[model samples]
Target: MHSSTLFITLTTALGLVSAAPTDKTYNPTKTSAASRTTHTVIAGRGGRLIFDPDNVVAEVGSIVEFHFNPLNHSVVESSFDTPCQPKDADSFFSGFFPVREGQSDEVFQIEVKDTRPIWFYCAQNNNAHCQSGMTGVINQNFDRQEFSLRAHKELAAEVEGPSGVQGGIQGGWRIPNPNPLGGF
Candidate 1:
């Protein structure tokens, strides 16, 4: 009887241990590269002076890749207060991509460092591209009605001239287009 009771107790303890739930907590800091999402934003697609999906909501560790279309265009970081201008020296800029025939062979990729709204615009001023509503935002907080892409565009429209850094910055990578031929 004593041996049976001991065996039953051991079996019950084992069962309880097996029934415990496993830990599946999500930690953003430890996210793997494979788990990160890459969002594609087409710049000047079909000769239009606009970013296809002008606004995107990206999380930390995610990537925003900009593919430049024909007639020369660029991506430059800017602030909400001063739209159509470079935010600061540390801001990211993809040098002008002059694609005359087809999409450029290179693509600008920037990783989302935080959840803050990142505003950007094309530096081309031929016909006032930035002022023509060539602006976009990432992770814009819709709750803040005062600060939005629409407001940014309004401010950009008021700016006399939109400018960018002299060259590319360190926050992003200008890599060869993964699908140059527009393939999957």
Candidate 2:
């Protein structure tokens, strides 16, 4: 009876341990070179920063490309603080810059590694670009709500000068006044 009870307890403990979830952080340091997929997101297509297809799906370590807008834009990690962490496909090309009129910062590419819901935003307006609903996501379960939140949050932070150059009412994010616009 004692031996049986001990075995049962040990089995239960092991079961519980295996069921526990692991902790994953939004890391922007380490980079892994995996098979890449050129996922292009076009900006300034219809007077808005749009990701065309709206939905992008890829395996881990794929290289996602974000074609910037002629409206002058930047990329950043989806967060309220505009961390400018760059959540595209890879973390190696992390940066924040203002593209010239009718120009962009080249093909923004990064690697999607972790299977976490990565977010991003435009580092221009008061997240005007993002707040205006110009945001996107990678990995994790995504539909609509999740994309808006993650994209806008990071855009907000980016606009706050992720590169120290605020739009200041000129070439910034086109924030739809009065309300936030979706499908951007």
Candidate 3:
């Protein structure tokens, strides 16, 4: 009888131990990467007239939120080789979001598809904007210092016009006065 009771107790204990959850079974961070994440970027700020962080590294499921300042500005996708010209296929334009004084705010959100590097510039009416080195990059493979040097050296011509391809912003994203008479 004693031997039987001891065996039963040992078997129950073993069953409970085997059913217990393991410490490594659940990892929030591993699964959280696919969860949506928002990253903010200033189109132009502090009178410097540049993307606050001209270079960014975004994961596959991240969103890049661009906030335009008081100054008239726009975000248009371009390529590294052709820094100024818009690559029609991969192009996205945020039109020219002019926030009036005392107005709320407008943001352009772009979702990341992959690790491919994305280059953009301000395609304002005045060509000087892009020429003045108003360019930004996302998911950049190279270092920030190296990307900036390349942006300054490469960005020469301004885009002929915005490609009229509006991307980055999902359907839920609303823009105040979205379709201006002659804007993207």
Tell me the TM-score of each prediction against the true structure: 0.78, 0.49, 0.63
Task: Estimate, for each residue in 29-103, the C-alpha lDDT of model 1 and write its tens digit.
Answer: 775546779999999987888998899998899999999998888899999998877889889999889887788
Q: List clashing residue pairs in candidate 3.
A: 109-168, 110-168
Tens digit of lDDT per residue, candidate 3, span 18-97? Answer: 55576777546654334688776776676556787887888887888777776677787877766666657547777677
Rank the models by lDDT, top first. Answer: 1, 3, 2
Best-to-worst order by TM-score is 1, 3, 2
- lDDT winner between 2 and 3, please give it: 3
- What is candidate 2's CA lDDT for residue 181? 28
Q: Over 4 Å off in model 1, which ranges?
A: 1-33
- Per-residue CA lDDT of candidate 2, range 114-176, in tens? 676665555555445655555556663645554454545444434543333222322113321
Name the candidate that leads on TM-score. 1
Sliding window of 10 residues with minimal summed lDDT for model 3: 175-184
Pitting candidate 1 against candidate 2, the one with the higher TM-score is: 1
Write down the lDDT that model 1 would get.
0.86
Task: In model 2, state the lDDT of residue 55.
Answer: 50
Q: Which stretches of candidate 3 lie over 4 Å from their true place?
A: 1-34, 102-104, 143-153, 157-184
Candidate 2 wrongly placed segments (more than 4 Å): 1-35, 79-105, 142-184
